[model samples]
Target: MAFEDVVVGEARPYADKVVIEEYDPSWPDRYRALADQLHAVLGDTLRLVAHKGSTSVPGLAAKPIIDLVAAVTDSAAEPSYVPALEAVGYRLRVREPDWYQHRMLRKRIVDGADENAHLHVYTEGCPEIAKNLAFRDWLRAHPEDRDRYAEVKRELAKREWRYVQDYAEAKTEIIEDIIAKARAAGVEVPA
Candidate 1:
């Protein structure tokens, strides 16, 4: 099913679960190590690779997942990068061509525990890339926004959710608000 087909609160037999964790100082180091591995695998195929999400922020609470956005020449061309990524334990989980041709890869679980990392692949210049980067920066620079977002996330995390995407979509309002503020303040949007 496409992203649009995912309804909020609709339970599925097998849905991706989420786990929010306290902000950890080691997150950056973890991201660096994972990015290094990815770089070694992806080499020059990635146009841009960055750590996004609240985990990337200094004090923001997050799901303990290192959200990395990698802009590829063409995410639709999964064959170009999927094999290399899989060879190193990354498994392509979601392929949504309907949504900016986005592709999500999760690191294979070592045992029963989650891999704690997700890599989102997008075509160069995808608008979602800018929005994610902008929100991450905005939260980093504004303590008030960061704290507020953290509160909202913590509150939302407490409730039962069908799919992780539903929990994510629930944050759209606050995300849009921050993006709107960024736009008003002359922040650049991805072209």
Candidate 2:
């Protein structure tokens, strides 16, 4: 797929399907390359740019998409950053003011069929920001939880779903349980 093929709000016939893959050691390097792309467009506007989610964990099985978190000045003020990101390859497809004014963008043509990238945007100090980072860190440090999460995702990926988001939602129970354990162990999970 070309850069233009994944443009914002475009309908995807197979968007609901989920396919998990084994750990790829090169994910971090790819993440850094994408970060470079973001920095070129966002400049200093981005407060934090990080690779999060299952793909960020070294041994975790994931849907082969890089999940990135980019926290900026004010996500609700799309005028401040949306256009610039759109100018690059990212295509903004989700906006939710009610939930920390979060936004999600995608640059799907990363490495042919083997890889893709998804950017999750949030304003500074959004609770979800900490959760995302903390979850990744916890899983990275705890092989048990990481393996469990991978297993959960592997099972969920096979279920029927109306949308890809539903597959993500199905992993919430396991995710939250793991997060709660992390917090209890003093992992500093953000509120």
Candidate 3:
């Protein structure tokens, strides 16, 4: 499927340049709170919820957005869970059925705070879920790679991006390299 076709509503373009901020100490607490809320909202429909991405790593510079991964019984079955999430102020932003039935929802101004978060939802047993968790765990365990990724992010942040997705896409090479290293070390990223 085409990229434009996957968006649920109007695509939000990033303003000029990407912003990478110093690690915030409050991220984990915020994640836990949100996770709790999701569990309450989703109940048995939610298989698992986890903190992923750069923000999950301690001391790593990130875009100041909390990235979360959620596994549901079937992400493509939006009717099963999307409405519940929307009631809690999460807006369905992207729905990529081709990509492991991935669905991304964004919540801005979480808990009356300016912080924003993205919840990447996928079906239970999806390989991407394991890959994301493994990547996050690898980064947390290896500071040298974490610092390297931070440096790359800072450099990328200096460039202008038409969309935040473009900036994220730019980091694919380094991300894949690190993931490769993690796999070679038996990080156990499921295929």
Candidate 4:
């Protein structure tokens, strides 16, 4: 999809039906499964891979899907990594140069028959990973904030949009606000 197609609050029918369900403690198992598949595909080129989204946060409601970040030693090494991933059914879909040289791969079953996951790949130590994890961790630690965010998600999910990313972006303001509060409160994720 084109960048223009990612307007906030515009849920693409293609990405509709996505919902944030109550937190599933088993999300970690799902991540582990994907991580194992990824590790077998990329082997040593993978520097670090971690569960870093809402699914990783305990008790924080999330879309019933796993979000993982695979950190490579260098992004220029995509040629070595991307092909292997595709062979295993994960297709590279998004590339962001301005955003920490991030790349995203969407995993689907067969010829786009089913949506499996959204995999975000980046070079080691990218700040975005930390930011994502921190927001999720902070939300998990602060139930009030988590509830507030969940309410925003519920309200947004009720709207129609062209893409789910649009729905995700709509939450950015509140997310950043929470992140700011966390920082102001001196909340930091353990290294």
TM-score winner: 3
Global Cα lDDT for candidate 2: 0.82
Question: Considering summed lDDT, which 10 consecutive residues are worst modelled in model 1?
Answer: 6-15
lDDT of 1: 0.81
How would you encode candidate 2's per-residue C-alpha lDDT over 1-191 as one tens digit per residue? 33223334654545456889899898889899888888888887888899998889999988878889999999988888888877776777777766787788877664232337788999988889889999999999999999999999989888877657767778889999999999899888876
Q: Is candidate 1 or candidate 2 better by TM-score?
A: 2
In model 3, how many backbone clashes occur? 0
For all candidates, the clash counts are 0, 0, 0, 8
Taking all chains together, each candidate's TM-score versus the true structure is 0.87, 0.89, 0.94, 0.85
Residues 1-191, model 3: lDDT tens digits:
54568888776677657889999999999899889989999999999999999889999999978899999999999999999998887889898877899999988883553348899999999999999999899999999999999999999999987778888889999999999999899788776
lDDT of 1 by residue, 99-174 (tens): 8998888774653334568898999989999878988998899999899888888888877776677788899888
Misplaced by over 4 Å in model 3 are 110-115
**Which pairs clash (backbone N, Cα, C closer than 3 Å) in model 1?**
none
Q: Candidate 2 or 3, higher TM-score?
A: 3
Candidate 1 deviant stretches above 4 angstroms:
1-18, 108-114
Model 4 clashes, total count: 8
**Candidate 4 residue-wise lDDT, 18-55, digit = tens:** 57799888788878888998899889989888887778
Residue 56 CA displacement from its true place in model 3, Å: 0.5
